[model samples]
Target: MRSTNFCLSTEGADVILATSSDEKYPPENIIDGQSETFWTTTGMFPQEFVICFHKCVIISKLTIQCYLVQTLRIEKSMSKDPVDFEHCIEKDLEYKEGELQTEEFSFPEFQATHLRFIILSAFDTFVSVHRVIAEGIAQDI
Candidate 1:
């Protein structure tokens, strides 16, 4: 029953795709395990990023820290490749000026090798994700 932040880049998590990214705000920052660094959407709504874990894992919960994000949808995939993701959860966040939004999601029975988070919309022209933490254990499948 070890708990770990599977989203850390050091943990073999990777950001496979993103709609738009600024040079200073690359998607890799979201999983860097540092709150100071972050990833930002360059433009438009419906921005997305896919995270591939090192191996299949049973995800128990997730913590997303972002700013200016209005709506978010998450999907998970158990396939070896990043595809055929099924819906996991969707949430609408509350916005507070000069403050970061911290949202937590729990899924006791969720297992996946990849997770995709889609930013459906934002409260502002752009949104920034400071960090994403996935707490879970690697499954021996």
Candidate 2:
């Protein structure tokens, strides 16, 4: 297992849902399905919110042969409308320690009652993720 060499931080009320040891899905607040979960920053977001994918450290770097955004969906509590933001932050990479890293993904107008990160593929090494920052708003909506 690669040591935790990177730091994970966020701007909003972030939560960490570690999936290294759990055999089944985490609780509702953290996860809803395999490689899927609902993330909330202020805990009291009424309808829409903005989320940012900060940073992820690739220990082996080789583990993740490829990184791509599989899906991006926007959810609202009072409404049943779901919008997609997967293409909001055109996927890009940065170089660090001979590894191609992921640049921060920030959605300026990501509307959601809740936020989530859906992992499409698993890397070769034991990966640790930082917190996803999401902010709820009423004025924006």
Q: Candidate 1 lDDT, tens digit per residue, 40-139?
A: 9988889999999959988889999999999999999999999899999998999999999999998876889999999999998999999999998889
1-141: candidate 2 lDDT, tens digit per residue: 423312113222222332333334222223211223333222221212232223322222111121222222322222222234332222323334434233344344333332334342323222222223232233222
Per-model lDDT: 0.92, 0.28
Would you estimate the TM-scores of all the predictions?
0.97, 0.32
Cα-lDDT of candidate 2: 0.28
Provide the lowest-lDDT 10-residue window in model 1: 106-115
Off by over 4 Å in 2: 1-102, 135-141
Once fitted onto the true fold, the runs of candidate 1 whose alpha carbons sit more than 4 angstroms away are none
Taking all chains together, the TM-score of candidate 2 against the true structure is 0.32
Please state the error at residue 37 of candidate 2 in Å. 18
Model 2 residue 28 CA deviation in Å: 11
